[model samples]
Target chain A: MSARATTRPGGRSARVQQSVHQAVRDLEAEVGRDALTVPLIAARAGVTPSTVYRRWGDLRELLSDVAVERLRPDTAPADHGGLRADLEAWAAQFAEEMSSTAGRTYIRDALLGDPGQGNAVRCSDYAVEQLKAIGVRAAGRGEAVPDVETLLDVLVAPLMYRILFRPSDLSTVYTDHLVAAALGRGPATPQTKS
Target chain B: MSARATTRPGGRSARVQQSVHQAVRDLEAEVGRDALTVPLIAARAGVTPSTVYRRWGDLRELLSDVAVERLRPDTAPADHGGLRADLEAWAAQFAEEMSSTAGRTYIRDALLGDPGQGNAVRCSDYAVEQLKAIGVRAAGRGEAVPDVETLLDVLVAPLMYRILFRPSDLSTVYTDHLVAAALGRGPATPQTKS
Candidate 1:
């Protein structure tokens, strides 16, 4: 459940969706992702298998739906005084979260069975929206910031490419380098975590 | 069959692998990806289902193997007179080839069920090798070109991100922009095909 769930607070449809989503999360933790089925999820949610089928069509789509919900950020990115510091902190945290095992799983799940790329767009939009907020904050403070697309190309894409295809090569040093490069700064200095 | 197949020219294992890979290609073209099964692939390859199971473990692994083979470039990137021209041409072609429907399918297949991430690494190595070749050519010509890692981050990553997640938003203009950015050039001027 996301902001949508809050809008339709008392709706039966929203309740069923919440219950089904909860069941999926519980079953994933209890058994694992591979063992999940519509009937099992429906049973756990106190709903009929037909209801699950009607709502989600199949296991893959259901998984995609759940993944999208999980990937939605709970809050706007934290403001860190200047645009450079704000972007650096955001990019560092983003790399850390997205490169994790569970994070990669969610990303893959979000893309699987996404024929229309709707789920993929939804996921990308989350990043886009967050970046836009950062840009707005920088502009308000009279600090120039790179456009959202530039940030995506220079920062987000590299992180995702590493997550999907070269997880072993990804490092905090690399993330810091990308943030610096995106801002048209000179060569990177390796960041030490506090 | 790749160069590996040539090394063991007439070996029984190589023969089996070639036949199986060929069968997968033909079947994929004929009946499509979703209808594929281990038994069907084995039958098509003139091998028993048990043989396929014993060799490949499952359909997903078999698909990954075929995808890796197909993703391997047939030849080294064609060199242009200058490093900038060579990189721009290569990036444009790479963007075109990878963003197609079949190409996207191959990428997905290569990644699916890849527990060891061996397939993913292999696919990445293909790009790495190509970029290295381009770099070598530039160095030979005494043209100071950007490093392969920079190309991967500023060029390949964006193409892949769009192909996997935001395909509709990707354009030739964007591809050209990435190449320019990677080369440390100013704003891109759109290229027209001859």
Candidate 2:
């Protein structure tokens, strides 16, 4: 990827980046992701194709950048007075967002052409930070909170696996079971296999 | 995707498939996946490019097919006298294989350009079949067996998630915890988060 002009203070470079990104989003929604091309995005952004290429390196990298931005949580995870409630709410919401068609596309785009795995790592870091916030909240309330990795293994992994593969049965029930398992409660009724 | 010419009995078509698949494997190892093209694969397989294109639709489809075949387990899940032991052994082995660089590449190939999700579903079916075999063996020995979906969500999901995203901690200990969780054992000492 090209050296991103990300750290520059507000100026023409940042404006151009914003316009190009907005163009990608607008074109993506209108024409869909599969049909997207650099020239079209540049044309819509009112920039030359060379400008887009020099900044983002390729379409995949540009898409990955957009996906990371989209995946960033808009707010802190809600606290529900207890770790179990907190986790159930968070897991359900996370699964619902990620299982959507657009969400899935962003995830695939984030992982694609990620030669250094930086995009994937950044996405994972977002999840880790959210989980840490929940953990801190639970610890403050004196509830015995499972660690973040434990939550990741028991809760997030199953949600993602189902979303990306067997997506037919992603529901509140499944997230509830994962929360229960992570809390050391026994397998609270295994999801019925189809 | 093109309508596959997969239904005819073993004949010229089967030979063509075998040769093409072998050519893909050989060329992927030699020239690397990114360097490959239909023309290169066709030339190596002693068939015309149109033959490959007609049968497989495109390079991504052909790669997906090869990945699914590579992912299929060659033998039954080994019986280890008890469900926990059985799952631990199988999970560890599965994690090891899927965490390898080659295995990760195959998985990515399997999922990419999978419009109907047939390739992804076939890979999931392989895991399901293996888990079912383990469950049946455990039940035959009077050991309580977790259902296939439970095994899938708890055991296979974490392994895959870790493999694809957070791969540094994929080890026997991680697989052991997943198996124990599926067996209703409490999270076996949460993996040391990196």
Top candidate, metric DockQ: 2
Q: Against the true structure, what is model 2's DockQ?
A: 0.56
Give candidate 2 regions above 4 Å deviation: A1-16, A46-48, B1-13
lDDT of 2 by residue, B89-191 (tens): 9888888888777788878888875767788888889899999998888888888888788787788887887776674576777778778778777664465
* Model 1: per-residue Cα lDDT over B1-194, one tens digit each: 12223234788899988988888888988998889998999999999999889998999899988888878887888888788788878887787778777788788888875767789888888999998998998899998877777777788888888788775445656677778888787432233211
How many angstroms is residue A189 displaced in model 1 relative to the true structure, after the best TM-score fit? 10
Model 2: CAPRI class:
medium
Model 2 clashing residue pairs (backbone): none
Give the candidate number with the greatest lDDT.
Answer: 2
lDDT by residue (tens digit), candidate 1, A54-89: 988888888888888888887888999888888888
Give me the overall lDDT of model 2. Answer: 0.80
Candidate achieving the largest TM-score: 1
